[model samples]
Target: MSAVSESISRRVTLGYIASHYGFELEPRFADGVTVTSVADTPDSVRPGALYVLRDDEEPSWLSVAVSRGAYAVLVPPSMAASARSAGVPALLATPDKATLGALAADIAGTPANTMAVFVVCGVEDDEIQADVVRVADFLHMLGNPVGIVSASGSSSLERELDMSYPLGILDIQHLLAVCSEDGAAAMVISADSQTLRPGALEGVNVDVLGTIEQLDRGGSQRAFKETRQRYGFSIDEQKRLVTCTEESGWLAGQASASRDLQSQRRLSLAIAMAMDAGVRRSNIRNALRVSKEMR
Candidate 1:
C-alpha cells in the first residue's frame, strides 16, 4: 500500500508484556488477519483478528499448525531459543504496562474501567485534566452522577464539564463532571457517611484528599459546640441566636458556632492546608460556610 493509504488503513494492535519493551502487530493483510500467542485462548481469538502468541508452552511444530486462522505467531522472550530453533516469527521483549495502557487508550479512544486510577498532585491553578478524565470515565461506566464537594480548590472536572460553582467555592459542580445523577447522590452519602475529621477521606471518591478533612473539620454539630464554648457565648443563647440567624440567613452559622475548640482549630488548620494545597482563599471561605448545623 502507498504510504498515505497505509497510514489511513493501518490500525495498531500492540501487545505489551511488561511496562517497558513490546512489539506492535504489523498487519501484512488488509483483511485484519494476524497471529498471536497461545496464552490468548480460543475464545479470545477472533476470526479476522491478529493473535500474537508468547512462547510459554509450545510443542512448536503442532502449536504453529493448530492456530487455525492465525496468520502468524509470536514467540515469547522466554522461548526465544525455542522460537529461533523453530524459525518462528517471535518478538523477544517486554513493555511498560502504564505506557502501553496509555498508548492503548489513545488508539482505542477509551480506557478500561479496571485500570481506572487517579493521581492528584498538589492543587495548582493549572488544570489537571488527565485525572478528571479518568474520574469522568469511571463514573460514566458505573452509571453514577457526580457530587461536588465545596472546597478551596478549583475542579478541573468542573471545567471539563463546563460547569461552575457559585459562592466562589468548589461545589457539587465538580462531582457532576465525574459522575452522573445517581453517582453524585452516592458521593454525598459517602462523604457524610463518616464523622468529620482531619485527613479523613473514607468514602468520598474525590481526587482532593484534603476535601474530606475540610468537610470533617467543618462538620456543624460538633464544630458549633466547640466554637461557642471557646468564644464564651451562652450555649443555649447561641443556639437560639444561630437558629434565628438560620431563619433569616447564614444557615450554617449555628453549626459554625456550635463546634468545639478542637473542631474549630481543625477547621482553621484545614483551611490553611487547603490554601497550601493551592486552594483559593475565596473558595475556602465559601466552603467553610456550607454546613448542616443551621438549626
Candidate 2:
C-alpha cells in the first residue's frame, strides 16, 4: 500500500510529530530526524520509518525495530529508558488507539481534509450500507467521483471494493488518502453504533453526518445530534416521504405504497442530501424516473 500520497511531496519530521502530539523526545537533538513512514510491527519497518511500540508489546521489539533501520520509535513511558539506552531517537508516550490513528493521518498528509466527507451512522448495519450505496449512486449521477467505505469494504468509481480488513481509523484514513489521490471529489462512510465510539473518528474531516433512525427530542439521540448536519426522515399520513434538515428546508416526494417505509425513508434522505450537495431538482426527478423504470 502507498503510505503517503504522491500529490503530497512534503515529508514529516520527528520533531513535528513530537511537538504536535506533546510527546517527549529522548534525545532533543534527534528531533530534526525525518520520518518517511510509520510502522507498528518490526517486520514492517523500513529505512527512516518511525516504529510505534504498543503498551502491551515487549520492550525487546524496540531494539529489533531500531536494528532494522527504524529512524525513530514511539514507546510508552515505561520503555523510555530502554529506548534511550538503545541509542535511537525515541518519542516517549503511550497514545491510545484513536490518538495513534490521528497521528498516522497527520503523517499521511491529512488527505481527508481535501475532500468532502459524509458519514452515515445508524442502529442497523444493513440500512447504513444501503444508504451509503444509494448516496454514492446519486453523487456519481451528479458528475462527482465518489469514494465509499462501508462495513462491506472500501471502493470508488476508479477502484474495485477491497475487503481485506476491518474498519478502523487507520484503514479509513488510508482509503481516504487513496481516494483523494485518485481525484475523488466526495466520500461516503457507513458506520454503526459500535463504530461510533469516542475518538473513533478523531482525525476524519466529516462534512455531513446523518442517521437513518428517527430523531428523539430527548437526550437519548445525543450521538446523532453531535454533527454539522442532522437529517430526519418521516412518512406522512398521505404516504409522502419527507426529509427535514437544519440547513436546508424540507424536501417531500410521493412515496410508493408498495415500498417499505425504511427504504423510502433512506431514499428520501439520500435525495435531500444530494440536493443539498448541488444536484439539480430536475436532474433528480429524471434520475428517479429512470431508476423506477429500471426496477
Candidate 3:
C-alpha cells in the first residue's frame, strides 16, 4: 500500500482505497467506480474525488461532493452502513481506529528509511536558521534536494521549493508519505517553537524525534552530518574525518579533503548532516559545495 515504489494498477477503484485502509466495500458499491483523485475533506473535494469523511461530522457537503461528481466516499463503519443501506457508494471501517496512523504511514512509506526530522534550538532566531530564506539558503548550500515545511510564509522556500508544506502542519503520517516518493533523498522539516519546545514532541515517535543537533558549522559548512553508529563519520580527528555513522560513510569518506580548511570543515559537516537527514548518498556530493557562509 506504499504511495511510492509500490506498483499501482491502472483504473483506480473504491475497492483500492478501501482495502488499503482495512475496510470492506459493501455489495452495492462492491464493484466500485474509478477515482482520479482523493480529497480528504468535503470542502476540498473535486469532481471525481474520493472523499475521506472525517469522524461523524458528515456535513451536507458529503452529498455536495457526490453531487459534484465525486466517484465514491470512504468512511467509518457506522456511516458506511447507513450509506450502503441507502444505496450511497460508501465503504466502512471502525470509527477512530488505532490503525489509522499505521495505515497513513504505510501508504506514505517508512520515515526511518526515507525521512529526517530535526529540532534545532539553543540559539537566537538570528543566529540559527530562523527564517525560510536562511533555511532555503542553508539547504541549497547543503547540496541535497530538500523540502521545507514552514509555518510562517516568509522564506525563499515560500516562493518555490522541491516540496513544501504550509504552516508547518507536517506530521509523521504526512512526512512518511512525502519521503516515500522518488527523488526524495531527504525531507528536512523546520522546527518551530511549538515543535522544538518541551512537551511539544511528547507523543511523537522517538525514532522520528531522534535529533541531530549541535551543529558546530562555522563559516562555510553551517555543516550537516548524520549519526547512525560509532566510527562512521569521515572527519579526521581535529580536522580528520572520524565519527562515521551509517550515513557519514558516503563519498568513500572524501568529506575530509579540501584546500580551504574552512570549506573542508563546512562541507564535511554538511555532507554528514545531509546524509543523516536522509539525503541520498548520490546527491550528497553535489550539495557539498559551500554556497554561502552563515551571516
Give candidate 3's root-mean-square deviation (CA, Å): 10.2
Give the lDDT of residue 217 in candidate 3: 34
Runs of candidate 2 with Cα error greater than 4 angstroms are: 1-9, 67-69, 85-87, 96-101, 161-165, 193-198, 219-221, 225-261, 276-283, 286-295
Instruction: Please list the residue runs of candidate 3 whose C-alpha ends up more than 4 Å from where it truly belongs after superposition.
Output: 1-11, 85-87, 95-136, 154-185, 191-272, 275-289, 292-295
Q: What are the Cα lDDT values of the candidates?
A: 0.30, 0.67, 0.41
| Tens-digit per-residue lDDT, 201-228, candidate 2 | 5567666666656665453246545432
Candidate 3 C-alpha error for residue 128, in Å: 8.9
Per-model TM against the reference: 0.29, 0.77, 0.51
For candidate 2, the per-residue lDDT at 169 reads: 50
- Write one digit per residue (lDDT tens) for candidate 3, span 1-295: 1111122112466676577665777664455676654445555455665566667565455676676566667676767554554445776766232344344333334343453443332224332233333333445665434544444332122233232222211133343344334344334434444322222221123212112233333411322222211101122223311222444433424544545543333344444544544567656554433332211
lDDT per residue (tens digit) for residues 84-161 in model 1: 454334444443323322322332222112121222222231222222332233333233333322222323233332
Clashes of 1: 41
